[model samples]
Target: MAQTAGVKPMAIAGRVALERERCLGMTDAERAWRKQWLKDQVLAANEPVHVEEYWKERINPIRRFYRKPLDVLFDKLTPMLGASRAADYRVITGKLGLIAVGVMAIHYYFKYHGNDWTKKGGWRVTRSKPMVLPGQPGFPYKSERSKDSDYADRGYSKSSLFDGK
Candidate 1:
């Protein structure tokens, strides 16, 4: 490093202290100018790279390949469906969701209530086990000789459900 004309040689610690004092003493405008000058110097030292153009060049072929079929489909449907409705994602999503839900509901109804519509007795809904309420015989625990051994069959059935464990 070149020495200043009027500056005296000093230890590294003394130089650091001097720099800290000088930085603390600078005005807001001087600090801002100094920051900008340093940034400009850093920018000037590095070569510029066109990141957006580079990425676009790399991705253009893949995008074009995938988009052609979709574009053609859109073009064909635009006039028939009305351009606005054809392009509206919300409407398409809502209709698709409704159809999916209807299909699932029909499937579950057949699964739970048998698909035998021509039967004499008609469809019968499958029954689930009854829920045991608080203060009931099997409120949170089952007795050793309980008629239903659903819970008692398991070795650790004495655990209290109310205790959150």
Candidate 2:
């Protein structure tokens, strides 16, 4: 029912988050070991002889390429991600949910309020000035005295709609 549906999403999200943490927490040593193992497999396949013969022939060169780097990488990484407690997984998953909620809330808030901050032309008002009609004179009360000058030039008169009563 409803409970199961809700639990499903949480479980899926938690698993994904756990997997991400696991990968992120992998030590350089572990990664290097994995990479070298893969490389060894590839080189072995490319050998012209049986597996034993290939290992015997190419072992030295392959070891030279993969072993040293793998050891160095493993040594560096082991200290960082070598061990994780069961509680650590739970904490990481919780953090993942919190992050997801925080991000969604921010996105929602922006989407909801972003339009209110912008005008028809996408212009944002940072000041408390009143909007002026296009082709009209400036603040009517303040510019009243100068009306006969610019107003007359623009063919506007005291009877114009923009002329403040």
Candidate 3:
């Protein structure tokens, strides 16, 4: 990439904020103030900057987005739930929501796809072991008789799906 004369390389985030403020009707003075603020911030923080720390914390795009909506939602619910209760409720619900989604995804994977997955620790049997579906690599059950079956004459198909109960 070549830099043209008079062309400045602002970060993509700064460009987005610029467009957002323009769309939301920012005055020219406000825009000038923002530009000055950015220049001042760059001048103040340019020296002794830790590249590793900046990349670790400030590189996330989602955090930039989630902050606004979460703040808005917290403000809306605070009147009803109180400040402390609202914050606690947000944290609890966020964790529980992530957990529910994870459980549902794992259940779906195991039920539909019978295969082992390689992980950081070791190999894991993500699906049913010795898969019960027909044409699977191994038999689902050992050579023992099924608990639901006692009739020697009846084939395996004779037992109802819920006969164990």
Candidate 4:
């Protein structure tokens, strides 16, 4: 399993050692009683954990907003793969998962960015006014706009069409 995941055995053993050490008042005899069993437990805990839990936590809740055609296949997979293979599957599926998450984030961003669903719809990246917190500077908005009018038209992103010299 470690080989499949590209994790060295020594690293796994090191983690197991750390786990064993974290147990307060654990005597050497008890600690060594079943090192292999303890190691296995720690190893399992360190992995992505059972696959069903991963799907429930990461995927299923978003079903209302986003449903994919392959979701049915993914949902039925645990019956064949079993929970033990879930961690490995998580590693294997990580790239595809990342792409899916990225796409979803982009979708949400474009969908909610302008508050288009609301009555007042304007394409604003952020509110122009700053929410004042106690002890912070007043209306201290972050901007790349130049303090000087001369430099304003000199910058790379010349969004403004003004030619004031």
Top of the candidates by lDDT: 3
CA lDDT of each candidate? 0.60, 0.53, 0.63, 0.57
lDDT tens readout by residue for model 3, 39-158: 766655457565867765865867757555666888899999998999998888778878999999888876655332222332235223354566765545564545545433233345
TM-score leader = 3
TM-score of 2: 0.21
* Clashing residue pairs, backbone N/CA/C < 3 A, model 3: none
Per-model TM-score versus the true fold:
0.23, 0.21, 0.34, 0.22
Between candidates 3 and 4, the one scoring higher on lDDT is 3
Clashing pairs in 1: none
Q: After superposition, how far is residue 129 of candidate 2 from its true place, in Å?
A: 23
Compared with the true structure, what per-residue lDDT tens digits does model 4 show for residues 64-106? 3444534454557767887557545755676687799999988
Q: Model 3, residue 21: what's the lDDT?
A: 57
Q: Could you tell me the lDDT of residue 120 within candidate 4? A: 52
Overlapping backbone residue pairs in candidate 4 total 0
| Native-to-model Cα distance after best TM-score fit, residue 86 in candidate 2, in Å | 2.2
Runs of candidate 1 exceeding 4 Å displacement: 1-59, 89-133, 136-138, 141-165
